[model samples]
Structure formats: structure tokens, C-alpha cells
Target: MMLEANNNYDKVHFAVLAIGATAKAMHTAPSDIYLRLKKYNLVKELLFDCYDTLHAESIEGVVWNITEALKSRES
Candidate 1:
């Protein structure tokens, strides 16, 4: 690895070389990280659902046509 991990935090004597030769193991288990990351996609699910609902609506298209006509008249 290019950079070493170190907890030797000191204001005056801090140097990059103080990093440990080996990496410290993560405290959070891999399974926990996987589950949390899986939950993070919940927002994506909601966004896709909204996109589908938007495409299903003819009302917005009607409103858009009226607004576009009004905008054309202003020019």
C-alpha cells in the first residue's frame, strides 16, 4: 500500500511515515455493511416509483400543453 494507517496523532511530531505497516481491520462486520448499503438503495426505489407514476399521468401532459401555448403567446 502507498499510504500506511496510523493512530499516532500528535500536533508537533506528526509525520506520514508514522503510519502502521498493516491495515487495521474494520470494526463493522461485512454483513452489517452489506445490509446498510442495501437499505441505502431504498431512496432509489422510491425515485423509480415516482418516475413510473409521472409517466402514467396524462394530467401533467395536459397542463404542459396549456402552459406551452401560453408561453408561445408571450413571444
Candidate 2:
């Protein structure tokens, strides 16, 4: 469903609805969705760390490792 908002409060309401719909579509609880979001954020952070660690080293290896780590997260 589409929601129209005239103000911040209305926007917040619509955001909540959108989140709920997303959770339902994924067939997971809202808490589970939150956890996945957290995991993705952590992965992003780890990618940055990997980049820094390999900045003076091997770029190809770092990219491979980062891609593997992200794929592992999917499973």
C-alpha cells in the first residue's frame, strides 16, 4: 500500500508501515529483520577494515576475501 504524508509524523507512520510490509514479505519477524540489518552494517564496517588493512598490501586478495565474507553472510 502507498501512503501519503504531509509532515514528519506522517512520514514516520508510513515508514513503519513499509517496514512491517517488508518483514511480512520476507516471512520473518521484525526483530529478525533488525538483526539482519545490523549484520549488514557490520559487514560494511568489516569491509572498510579489510580495505585499510590491504591498502598497502594485495588489493586482489582483499577484494576476494571481502567478497567471500559477504557471500558467507548470505548463508
**What overall lDDT goes with each candidate model?**
0.30, 0.47
Q: For candidate 1, write residues 1-75 as lDDT tens digits.
A: 322222222211221111110011224443443343235442133223233443344644523432343345445
Q: In model 2, state the lDDT of residue 73.
A: 76
CA lDDT for candidate 1 = 0.30
Cα lDDT for residue 16, model 2?
45
Output the worst ten-in-a-row residue range by lDDT, candidate 2. 42-51
The RMSD of every model to the true structure, in order and in angstroms, is 24.0, 13.3
lDDT of 2 by residue, 1-75 (tens): 233234434534433443344456557775664455457773335433333454344544544544454467777
Highest TM-score: give the candidate number: 2
